[model samples]
Target: MTHNPSPRSRFGIRFSILARRWRRALDAHLAAAGLTDATWVPLVHLRESGHAITQKELALLVGVDGSSLVRVLDILSRQGLIERRPDASDGRARLIHLTELGEQRVTEILKALREGEERLLVDLADSDIATMLECFDKIEERLAPATDSKDTSR
Candidate 1:
C-alpha cells in the first residue's frame, strides 16, 4: 500500500477535512429537527440556562459577530423558535431566550446529535474517543494563549 506522508504532516489540512465532514453530518442530523448546526450552541445555551442571556454574551459564546448573530436570532424568532426582549437592567442591550417551541425543537436537536455522534464514532473504541477529545482540548488550550497574546499586541 502506498503511504500518504503528505497528509500525516499536514495536520491542519486533515483537521479541516474532518471538520467539514463533521459539519455536514451534523447538518444532516439537524435537518430532521428543522434546525441547522449553526443554531445548536445558541439553542442549547438558552435551554440549559433556563433564563434569558444577553445577545452579546450569546454571540461571544458562539464565536460569531454580533451582526451575524442578530440575523440568526431574527430568523429563529420568525420561525417561532426563540424570542428577544430588552434587557431589564441594560436597556440598550437585548436578552435572548428560547420559546416553548424552541425548547421542544432544541430537545429534538440534542437527541439527533447524540444519535449522529454515536453512529459517526461507531468504528472507534471508547478509549479512542476519549483521546481524540483530549487532543483537541489540549490543542485549543495551547493555541488560545498564543492567539490572545497576538490579539493584545495588535
Candidate 2:
C-alpha cells in the first residue's frame, strides 16, 4: 500500500519550504545593501534589542550556533558594523554593540524589509493577515514546550 500523509505533515513541509523561500527572497532584496540573511539577521536582532547583548543571547535569538555566530560577527566587526565591548558586570563576558554606521544600515534595512513585506502581502486582506498571524502565534506557543525540553536535555 502507498503511504499517505496527513494535512499536518503536509503543513509542516510547506511551512519549511515557505521559510526557506522567504529567506532567499529577502537575501536578494538586501543584496544592494551588502546584506545577506546571515549578516542582516543578526544586525536586525541587535537593533531591535535596543541595547547591547551577549553573544550567547544573540545566538539564541538568531537560532544559530555560537561558532557560526562568531564567524558572522567577525565579518560584521571587520565591516565596522558592530563592536564587541567588555561587559562591565562580567569581566569574562562581552556585549555586542552596533556602531554608528551599523545603526544607520539597520535603519535602511528595516525600511527595505518593510517595503518588501508590503509588496508581497499587498494582496492579502487585513483579516487574512490577522488570521495568519494568529495561526503562527498558536503554533509558536505549542512548540515552546518541545523547545524547552530539548534545551534542557542538552
Candidate 3:
C-alpha cells in the first residue's frame, strides 16, 4: 500500500519551490555583473565580514562542499575578485579575503540585490515582510538541530 504524505511535507515542497523561484530572481539580478549565484554569495559573505575568513568557514557559510568551494574560489581568484592567504593561526589553513575589486563589485551587487528583494516584496505589507523573515529564521533554527545531529553522525 502507498502511504500518503502529511500536510507538513506538502508545505515543505511549496517552500522549496518558493526558494528556488526567489533564487532564480536574485541570480538574474547578479548576472548583469557577470556573476552567478554561487560566486556572488561567498563574495558577499566575505565583504560583509570585513576580515580574513577561513576557507572552511566560507564553505560552511555557503553550504557548499570543499571541492565545490575550491572550484568557486579558483574562479573568483582568477577574476581578481578575491585572494587566499595563509592563516596566521594555522600554518596549513588558508584564509579568504575580498580584494579591492571584489569589495567594489560587492558594493554594487549588494545594491542591486537589495533593490531586487525590495521589488519582490513590494506587494507585501511591511508587517507581513517582518513576519515572513521571522518565520524563516524560526525554520532555520528548527533545522539546525537536525543538521548538527547529522554532522555528528557523519
Candidate 4:
C-alpha cells in the first residue's frame, strides 16, 4: 500500500516551501545592497509604525525574542540606521527610532520588494491573485487563535 498525505499536510508543505523560496529570493535581490531579511524587515516595520516603539514591541513586531533583537539593534545603531532613547513616561524603557539613513534604506527595500513581486506575479491574473489573497486571509483567521495561544504560553 502506498502512503498519501492529507490535504492539510500537503497544504502545509507547499506553504512552507513557498515561504522559504520567497525569503531566499528576497535575500538574493537585496544581497548587493547588504540588507538581509533580518536587518531590513525591522526597518520596514519601524517606518510603517509611524511612532516611537519600545524594544519589546519591536521584537514582537519582528517575530523575534527580545534578546535576539538586541544584537540586530546593535548592528543598526553602529551603522547609524537607528537610535534608542529612553521613553518619556518610563525611563527604563527605550524607544526605537529609525534614523534618516534607515528611512532611505526602507524606501529602497520596499522598491526592491515591489519589483520582485511584480516579476513573480506577472504571469498570474488579478482575479487569481485576489482569490489567493482571500484564501490566505481565511487561513490566517483560522490560525489566529493558535497563534494567540502560543504567544500567551510564552
Q: Rate the local accuracy (lDDT) of all candidates.
A: 0.82, 0.90, 0.86, 0.88
Query: In model 2, which runs have C-alpha deviations exceeding 4 angstroms?
Result: 1-9, 152-154
- lDDT tens digits, residue span 19-67, model 4: 9898788778887667788899889889988987988778877899999
The window of 10 residues in a row where model 4 has the poorest summed lDDT is 145-154
> Which ten contiguous residues of candidate 1 have the minimum total lDDT?
145-154
Q: Listing every candidate in turn, what is its Cα RMSD in Å to the true structure after a full C-alpha superposition? A: 3.9, 3.0, 3.8, 2.7
lDDT of 2 by residue, 6-53 (tens): 888799889999999987777788886676889899999999898999
Give per-residue CA lDDT, model 1, range 67-107, as digits (tens): 99888888889989998888888788788988899988888
TM-score list, all predictions: 0.73, 0.82, 0.81, 0.82
- What is the Å distance of residue 25 in model 2 from its true position? 1.1
Clashing pairs in 4: none
Stretches of model 4 off by over 4 angstroms after superposition? 1-9, 152-154
Once fitted onto the true fold, the runs of candidate 3 whose alpha carbons sit more than 4 angstroms away are: 1-9, 48-51, 149-154
Better of 3 and 4 by TM-score: 4
TM-score of 2: 0.82
CA lDDT of 144 in candidate 1?
82
> Which consecutive 10 residues in model 2 have the weakest lDDT in total?
145-154
Best by TM-score: 2
How much RMSD separates candidate 1 from the native structure?
3.9
What lDDT score goes with residue 122 in model 1? Answer: 86
